[model samples]
Target: MAAVLEPLPQPDPPGAKTSASTDASHASGSGLKPIKRLISDSRIERIVPESNAATHLQYCSQFARDFIRADYNFCAAKVTVARGGKIRALDAAFRESGEWLGKALTWIEQHPTRSFPLEHEVIELKITHPLAGRLVRCLTQYDRIFVRSMEVLLAGKIQSHERETLLLNAGKRLKHIVQVCIPDNDAYLTDGTRKTK
Candidate 1:
């Protein structure tokens, strides 16, 4: 039996060289005061915003594109019953990008469209990374549908003026919520969170 693992170690990449203390004290140098925040009401987001969905969409597309470029597989799968690992990877990405990702997913779930093409002109033919090609191949038809839905949502291209399809806007709306939840900090980490002590 052969198995592959893709480990997501949280906010920090595995090879990052940095020192941080999980201590709250390190976060606040004796000020002992909660920083006033504009959003003050939600979870943190990995992408920063210029206070608009357009910006969020830009980041989202790049997030997908860059993610496709990264080499993060842990092992090759010899046998599998389903594509749980692939689904998990996508879920982790959504959570990291913003709360909106989950919202978008919900909309896609309800608005199931089997029209996802097995071959599309938009899927870039040139993938420079060798590993990404195999990764792409492992994607199930359902997985492809889900990802394509996200790509469309993040692209913000409103083609159908149908009200039912407007649910795609949920991603944009959640992105707004993310904008408010960002913490006030002197230093911003790569993922846009304040450094912990």
Candidate 2:
């Protein structure tokens, strides 16, 4: 089975310092077409197994890693695995401590028919300089992957609009997350309302 932390080509040197502008440049060249084309695996059955959730979860995590390894050649670095159980120790790169995390929370809330306790899981692939911006820009893309994976896992059938809706929802969610990360003075407000962030 593949692990979720699949490696990709390094956009910048390992441990290289980064700035927002550099990240934007890398992100701009990330070739949205390629990343978008590498849609979620149609073969994933579920995040957790019906009989043995832990064993199955581990198996799935490893499988996700393998899938990433096979799919993204320019990934530049090993992916990171952060499960709901591990949320308290999130990386400090994030400006806000608990923002951009509703994905996991929502997943945990909506999980159904599981015999064992399973929290949300995030398999993050670090985007090197320049590419980091691309990651942030395209962060919402994963919403489709998450939703589709869950649909297939529990319903045993993929919803036609699940991907689109997920992507759209991701955009909304991500904007909120970014807003939260930005400083109050630097934040963008529409019509005196603090957007969803």
Candidate 3:
């Protein structure tokens, strides 16, 4: 005879630390308002300003490098996936005096023919953390394209040329990503009106 599978019973909730009446009194005493956590889905959110995108790319790259050095799986994966494959390892970024922006800026200024190598280190690292691999893959294409586009835009800007085209292209790219990643009802107005879905 074959045995049938059975579901396990749910456990009872832990006893309350405070009574409902006490909660209300506590809330009233100091005008304590319940805080709703702002759960933003970055995956869907469009890059606002080009500057914002740059900031994110730079910081995410820096974090990835530090995380790799720390040997922390969680942080490393978050950083690597967040960047996609557009960036090099964090160790490379901190070559001189352990400075991130300094090294990056210097590299940019010097305009090295080969700034950084694109190694699939993250993919191997992802073996220990599959989610990190996914994140890395997502960010790589976007980051690379965004960075290249930004460079062209900056060159135009520095040359005192009209940046309308550059701005438009960046906006378009950001919009495309945002549309894919963000749901319609994510944003809201100050007056508590939810954005149209």
- Candidate 1 C-alpha error for residue 133, in Å: 18
Question: Can you list the residue pairs that collide in candidate 3?
Answer: 44-181, 44-182, 65-90, 81-135, 81-136, 84-139, 84-140, 85-140
Give candidate 2's root-mean-square deviation (CA, Å): 17.4
Clashes of each: 3, 16, 8
Query: Candidate 3 residues 1-197, lDDT tens each?
Result: 10111223245478835567875664333232322211222321322211211111221232233323332233332333333221222222222212322333343344323233232212122222333333333344333433443464455423323333433443343233323222232343333233455
Which parts of model 1 are misplaced by more than 4 Å?
Answer: 1-63, 70-98, 119-197
* TM-scores of the candidates in the order shown: 0.23, 0.25, 0.22
Kindly indicate the candidate among 1 and 2 with the higher lDDT: 2
Q: Model 2 compared with the native: what TM-score? A: 0.25
Model 2 ranges off by over 4 Å: 1-156, 181-197
C-alpha RMSD for every candidate: 20.8, 17.4, 19.5
Per-residue alpha-carbon lDDT of candidate 2 for residues 103-168, written as tens digits (9 for 90 to 100): 543553464533332233334433333322333333333433453455545654435475445545
